[model samples]
Target: MLSLRTRFTALLIISVVLVLVIAAVITAWLLRKPPEVMYDRVLAEKAEFALLLLRADPLAAQTLHITIQEKPAKDRIDQDRTDNILAEGRRQGYTADVVVLKSFNPHRWDIAIRLDDGRWAYLDFPDPAPFPYLPLAAYLALVAIGMTGIATYVSNVMMRPLRILDETIAKIRPDGIIHELPETGPMEVRTTAKTINRLATRLNAAVSSRMRMIAAAGHDMRTPMTRMRLRAEFVVDGDDRQSWLKDLDELDHIADSAIRLVREEISPAAQEQVSLDAVLRSVAEEISETDLPVEQGAIKPVLVKGAPFALKRALRNLVVNAATHGLGARVSLSRYGGEAVLTIMDSGPGIPQDLLGRVFEPFFRVDQARRQIVPGAGLGLAISQEIIESHGGTITIVNRREGGLLQTVRLPLCKPEQD
Candidate 1:
């Protein structure tokens, strides 16, 4: 399907051209033979005047004896065609009922008129082409060019509002920033913009509501979670008690992560210009301090608009996840096109193809049995994704073909992707 602007512009051009062509055809049809008929009428009148002069003087009629053919001169002036020509000349107010069309040369007219005095008069006159052909062709060419210019101007006027609406929609975000489109165009355009704004408003409301609910639930669970932890301390020193303590600890961590996710969603740190290279390096240094085999590649300082703390947390999550599961990590930062890209490659056994997607789901673990060994509530990737997306970015993880997993994060260098 064509876009709105393209469709409208095409239709406008076609309609104007079609109208011009149809109007020209109709005008030509109505005007086809009138000019030729008028010329024939004038010829008959001139021939009659000459006959009248000869009738006034009998000697002159014999002296000027002009031959008149009763039969047509040739096939070019047959009886039927001659009759039709005579009828047209009479219709144009000429006394041509008794006039005979004798011959029609290329640029000459020859007609015979029967006089009131029982004499025949033949008149010969020069005839040029019926209409101004070359001039009219030039005129039509100018008309076509003018029509094309008008069509383009009208297309721009009709589609200006839609262009503005599209550009505004492209900058939409979930960060409570609602850019209102101009509602001052045609009625349909204004209505469309209003509908989009209303949808954005409802989306913001829904997100805020979810964040509040999640934050409230996590906060309310903290008291009971602490009480449960305190109660676990009294259990006998055995495997069962140890398992109970571990489960409690996991629950507390999950509840804390829930609140953290809600906070990041609802009130992300204010966006500011920050060095993307610095953020990645900071996360790499912290991971290296823990004796993890984390390598930070040479990175050029790239500036982007985002919340520094939230950005760092997301980078750290990817780095830590790689170090934990992939055995080691290599972090690199670069600018690609209009975006800043951070890549984390790990050298562990790659995640199963089927489980790579589920790894980002909250509480989803690729290797469930490994949970007992590597302690985490499984919210790292989920939280990281939410944070990156909030800052107008995307995070993706795919297994490396060689032996490990690769995670790539791309953040827009300019205004975030709101659409």
Candidate 2:
């Protein structure tokens, strides 16, 4: 389906051009008949005026020098001839077109005028051909050309505001900062922009509220966490003490993850041109330091438009999550169509079928019963999805047939704006 802007432009331009074309056609048709009518009127007037002069004085006919003859000398074969003469003449103070006659030349028009003495005055001349069609066709062609240009110009002017609206709406996202729409253009366009700005204001306020709650919760937990850590220092060294410290450490990890999530949501790094291969290689190199058996596949210099740090963090999160569950991760980056494709595969046991779809939810954990295996909260996949999607990308995780979980991320290659 076409977008609203596209539809409007198409409809507007087509309607205008069609109307103009129709008008031009009708005008051309009407013009064609007028030439024939005008010629008949002039021919009748000339014959009538000559009849009037002769009726007043018979010698006036012989005195006339204009080209009128009882029989044209240019006559050839009598293939076409008339059988009547003055019988078709009009006597009601006006003259009609001349009547045809048998004696008239076959190739020329024959006109008969009734004189006062009840005699027939025969006049013959070749018919004037209808006006040539080329000029009329040219006039219509010019009209069509002008109509096309006018329609295009009008459509562009009208669709300009809607194009701006589309661009503004596309740029709106939870990542980075919210930018207001430009309240300009036509009245309807200005209204639409203001409405979008109001909606953005409401959305930003909601996000701010949630982020403040997360920040506050993280802040409030720090003092108690510190006091608990200090108290644990007095405990005697034992397995139970180790378990308590581990549990507290996990709680601290959750708080820290929560704070980072809120901070990232509030302000992801600004977008810029960055190399996808570079970010993937850097993240894989750091993960390899932990001896996780991660491999960085051959990557090209695929420059993407996004925040480099945010993308790096997203890649790191996917790798770290895969490493924690699936033993280790193998990372690779490549180009597909107009998108940058990033794949992360892990060798550990993949998530259960029932929990696979829910893994990306905030703080969702598949291994709830195996908390000791992984101490962090279940925000890694969720955060990674947020980061990727904010940059106009998609992240999906599926279990590989061979083994382990496979995550695929695809980000659209940004195009430059035209001047």
Candidate 3:
């Protein structure tokens, strides 16, 4: 499909060309030649004048471009035209026979009249012809080129406002925040920019409100959670007490994870060059100490610009999620193109295809029954995604063909000076 600007330009050029063609047709009609009767009348008058000159003085008439000849030229004669001219001349009261001689060029013809001295008088008057092909074609081509340039310029000028709007919208950050646009340009453009700025203001307010609410809710829950923990310690039955403590622990984990997720979204961390390979090794060793099935594989030196603690936390969440849910996780770090790629592969049954998209949603569990066994609030992946994205990185999870889940995280590699 043609873009709006291209279509607009084409439409304008086509309309202009159509108008030019119609005007040209009307102009040609108005400036066209006189009818054949008028032409014949005029030719007869000129022929009679030439005959009079030839009869008066043949030598003087030849000097005046009226030649007296004993015989007509050998060029082919147009018999019909010659008869018509002779008839017209007789009708004008001239007692003379005239012949129309055809010239070698198709566009030209001459007239011959019988004079009183028995000599033929030749009058050379070429017929009017249309404009030549090459010059006309060149003129039309120049007109087309000029029209195209003018159309393109007008299209770009008209579409400038929309282009500005599109570019401003594209610059929106991953956190759903867009900066205010400069309210400048034409009236319509200024109005549009002003409206967008107001919208961005409201959007930022909404986002801030939501983050504050989450943080407040998480903080408020900790109080009740602590009271519940204190009360659960007094339960007489051992199994009942253990279950209560476990439930309370889960609630505590949920509140802490919620607070952390909000923090990751709201806070902008200072970036510094961090060795991603070293971080991966540390996270693997730490998880291994807890007896989690985390095996460190190929680790290459890759430097990325991000907060050291935040990057480590994001990586740890991913590694833990894989090892806990997918049986064992094989962690590796490598440089691919301009990015540092950290991949975690596991061996357990992969997530169902139907539920893959929902994995990134907070507190979304593939199997709710595994809540007691896995010991998570199901916000691990969500937190990891938020943190990675905040650092201008991406994290993706997919089911492996060989039976397991694969988690891949990519961050832009830092330049040499940053190292």
Candidate 4:
């Protein structure tokens, strides 16, 4: 699983790529239009002027013909003069076409001259400078590169704040520690950063306050619990004493449950690399010593970085719960992909479908025939979930089709298989 910062960076890079692609597309569209269109328009207007001059001074036309042929009419047009004509055309937003033909028939020329007055005028000119493909292609390529660079720069700039936000959020611990996000970037981005930081602060304060209250309550109740136990021991009658002792034991159980709940909620980070197989074997052995029909699978050593004690406690809770409520308990451990999975199957009646999600909540128990049969404060699954989650893992319970409850715990593997 990638960290939030890495994921955000990847998304930003993809967005940059997308923006660059769009910019490249728009640049290509703008660059693809023929460069010759402007040149042709300029030439056409010059040809029309030349023809009009010829009509005005017919004798001058012969002199101009000698000069025009020696220095082609296209060549006779000055560079500055052509530029001025194009600039003027742009100012007026007009488009013209110029075609020059060499060694043309006088009759066809006359027809073209007559047509010029009628709007079908075809001024044929000699092939102008070889198609300007090299310069046009170079210009378009430069434009594409510039556009792509700008797009990439803007994308990087836009992504910087988000990257910082992601990094800040990733630093937040599950125990609800808040890390402030940087308040920078565009107006909208700055607003988002402030909102996220405020949310984190609120959540942290809420979780810390709740955990402190639970811890304080659990701590305060222990002295009263001890005093009550001491008082219960002094009951006179044998049956009455036993009943009072049982009540005291129940009170002790309640105190233990309360303390365990608070501890799980405010657990400190104590993760380390541990062998999953060893932990499972130890749990199975302890359970088997109690005469429970607990079976073990062909175990492989799977290394994972996590709170080993918490994991063991979680697994033990599952096994004990199963043994107390189900016909038998069977535990299996295996590696799948980059994760270590420990599945504990029991022959107990499965939980109701609707209650499966609620089973993880503290003190939530399913109402069923076996509800009273099991001795629990309903915190077993909740504790198990807390332990697993603290180790960056998950515990899920599902009904087996073969008629039982199946609890699967998945922990990320620390050691990957070498190919």
Candidate 5:
């Protein structure tokens, strides 16, 4: 199937062709009628010939042995007669008008005369003859050919800017870094390229600043957390000490999660192709050894260009999240079309429809009241989504009809040559 842009371009080309055809048709219609002056000249020439023949020898007029018949005016002349006269005229090398009159009222006889000879001679007089529809048809064909050539050239030239725009947009990274585009082409295209470059630069700077601030805050919180842990250890009551320890642990988790989010935001460029099936199988095996009730299915080696560590971390997060929230989690890996799919399904209660969209948001646990029970900062899905998107893929959640929640990760497959 063609993309929207390609279909639209094709429509444009077709429209141009249609317009050319319509214009050609209109031109042919306008040139349909023959010149009236040519007919009058033919009639005058025929009358003059009769008078000349009479003056040469009045008796010869009666001996001429030619018949003058009365008939209705035809829309077109008889092809056979026209051809014969035209041939005779050409052989005689004489330009004469052969007019076929429908009737000579009782006064004079009407006649048909053939005029000049060659292709151009047909243009001299408009009686339908020798290649009747040829001139108009030829003219239309020529116009169509010229118009098609012009339209094709113009369409190609006009599409170059759009192609450049598509390529430039494709190269933009989610990290928000902007690269300068080639400032070439029409004025409008150049202006658009410049504007996009400026916007990308601003976005890059803003995201960088945010990531730095988050990282710095996480770094700054470590000392206070350490100090709090120390003070809690000094508490006399065991329960109080345990409470303080739990609080410190929560704080540490928060700091770590924040740092991880920041690092993911500024993730380094992916360099190698990683086999996703192998990564999933490894995660499944590790979980199984721990007796987590996780099962692996139909694992196949599917390679994709990405940061291997990040991808592994993302897959691990999904598997762990499923096992933690829903018991008897099952991990499955497969390939469909040109994409690699990793699905994690759990037998636990599925998420509410309204919260499905928000599940991937950082720190947005579904059961706020039972946040502690879930044992997470609510950044697992968020991180996983980021990782998949960075690798030019998608992560989605679907509620199973039978029961439970399904986490689906789709990654574009890397070509063998690319690997």
Candidate 6:
């Protein structure tokens, strides 16, 4: 599909060309007759008039500047132009032989009319140059070029508002933050910017309200959870006490995860250059102490700009997720282009293809059975995604063809000065 600016410019050029073509055709039709025909006819009429006056009074005709000749003038006229003059003279009822002669001056023409007494009456008259089609074509081409330039300028001016709108909208962050647009330019542009600003204000308010509600609910749940745990400790039967404590512990984990997820959404932590290889190695070593199989491979020093603690937490969640769910994890870090690329591979069963898209959704799981096998609320992936995206990074999960799952994380590398 063509853009609006391109379409507008093309339409304008086409319209101008069509108008020019039509005007040219009309002008050509109106001037179809050659100027020589009219010039010859006028000369022929003057020669005839001079002959009539010469027969009546020779001296008076001589005073009229009529040059009487015994034979035709030596100056030659073009055959086609002579024929046209003859035809025109015949149309005016003069069947006598008529001859048109060229003059020494290009702007004058002489004509000879055979007199009744076998003499020739010669007369000279002004002539005009023929109609110019070549110059007209050149003029039309110049006009077309000028019109094309004007069309391009007008199209750019008209589409400026839309271009500005697109660029401003692209700057909007995924965290529901809206940057106000400058309400300048034409009236239409100003009105559009005002409307977008109003919509953004409402959207920001709604997102803030929701985040606050979730954070408040998570914080409020901790008081009751502490009370329930204290009550669970006093249960008589060992099995019942254990069951109650386990349920309370799960509820506590859920609240903590919920609060942390909300905090990840709202946190604007300061960022600095951090070594990704060190973070990966530390996570691997810490997980290894817990008897979780996490092997480091191809660890390369890569510096990226982000909060060190947040980056560590996100990486740890991914590593722990793979180790716990996918049996064991193999991690690698390297610099690819201007980005730090990290890969986590595991040997356990991969997620179903149908449920892969929902992995980033909060509290979403492949199946309810995993909820029993895995602990805490299913917000690890969601929180990690928020953290990664906040730091201008990306994370993706895909089922490996051989077996298990592959988790890939890419973060833009910092400048050499930051390292």
Best by lDDT: 3
Q: What lDDT tens digits, residue by residue, belong to model 2 across residues 1-419?
A: 88765676677667766776787678767655455345455556667777777767777666764334443233431322221222222322455334444444434565565555556677666765555568766876787677667766776667777776677767767553468988987787788778878877988888888889988998899899899988887789777678778888988988888887876777767899888888888888898897766777767668789988878888988988887778888788777778878888988888899888898888898767867676787787777887888788998889999999999999887653221
TM-score of each predicted structure versus truth: 0.70, 0.68, 0.84, 0.65, 0.70, 0.84
Q: Whose TM-score is higher: candidate 4's or candidate 6's?
A: 6
Ten contiguous residues with the weakest lDDT in model 3: 128-137
Candidate 3, superposed: residue stretches over 4 Å from native: 1-3, 10-65, 73-96, 102-107, 416-419
lDDT of 6 at 354: 91
Estimate the overall C-alpha local distance difference test score of candidate 6: 0.84
lDDT of 3 by residue, 232-282 (tens): 999999999999999999999998999998888888689899998888999
After superposing candidate 4 on the true structure, give the runs of residues whose Cα lies further than 4 Å from its correct spot: 1-58, 66-172, 237-243, 368-372, 417-419
- Root-mean-square deviation of candidate 6: 3.8
Error of 5 at 122 (Å): 22
Better of 2 and 4 by lDDT: 2
TM-score for model 6? 0.84
Model 6 C-alpha lDDT per residue in residues 1-419, reported as the tens digit of each score: 99988999999999999999999999887876556566667766765666667767868756877676786645575556678877887788755567767667877776677777787777777665556799889999999999999999988888888877787788877576888888998887888789889988998889889989988998999999899889988999999999898888888887888888888888867999888889899999999999999988899888899999988889998999999999999999887778889999999889999999999998887778876667768888998999998899999999999899999999998964332
Worst 10-residue stretch by lDDT in candidate 1?
A: 68-77
Candidates ranked, most accurate by lDDT first: 3, 6, 1, 2, 5, 4
Better of 2 and 5 by TM-score: 5
Q: lDDT: which is higher, 1 or 2?
A: 1
In candidate 6, stretches whose alpha carbon ends up further than 4 angstroms from where it belongs are: 33-70, 73-84, 101-110, 115-134, 416-419
Number of the candidate with higher lDDT, 3 or 6: 3
Candidates 2 and 6 compared by lDDT, better number: 6
